[model samples]
Target: SQQGEEDPQALSIQEGENATMNCSYKTSINNLQWYRQNSGRGLVHLILIRSNEREKHSGRLRVTLDTSKKSSSLLITASRAADTASYFCATSGPGYSTLTFGKGTMLLVSP
Candidate 1:
């Protein structure tokens, strides 16, 4: 069964704007990860936030985790047309040795 599910299913934004995506999980997780996939390319790891962590940042990307609510959010600042891609949320922990990925959120950034 899938542990995580991304909300909004799709998002549309203009260049230089900010985009936000959210995820909710079903079970306890030691860590949750966000990824981006550009069309035919493979998914690229974005950030992994531990259960103990509330937030993380890398470049223009910001991620927040709330284990108590079993939810997380990803924010991309200064969105660009190049930032257009599908984002996925995945989770793994405890008895799970593999990650379970959500269906993904398709983001379209217009120039």
Candidate 2:
């Protein structure tokens, strides 16, 4: 598949701790985007780092991309209970309007 799969289907962490998730893809991509979805809600864009970029950070979130390995990782620092959600990595086709997503990593941050 051209899409990526995240390791560890689920992750649990305490408030104020850090959480990390990794994604592996089979094909080259233009860019990779990380999104967070609250329970039964729409996904909120977290960050986008292109194939040419190595690392990017947003607020308490950090993302790293390794195009040569066709993989990426997302790190959430000092996570809070509100951060509990499903995280997905998305990449779009050059002309397609749809984005392909992996099964996603479920994160639960307990207070």
lDDT of each: 0.95, 0.89
TM-score of each: 0.97, 0.93
Clashing pairs in 2: none
**Cα deviation of 79 in candidate 1 (Å)?**
0.2
Predicted structure 2: lDDT = 0.89
Q: What are the runs in model 1 whose C-alpha is more than 4 Å off?
A: none
Q: 1-111, model 2: which lDDT tens digit per residue?
A: 539798778999899999999998887788888889999899999998888899999999999999998899999999999999999998765554467788899999999
lDDT for predicted candidate 1 compared with the true structure: 0.95
**What is candidate 1's lDDT per residue for 55-101, written digit by digit as tens?**
99999999999999999999999999999999999998876568999
- The regions of model 2 sitting more than 4 angstroms off are 94-97
Residue 28 C-alpha lDDT in model 2: 74
* Backbone clashes (count) for model 2: 0
Give the TM-score (vs. native) of candidate 1.
Answer: 0.97
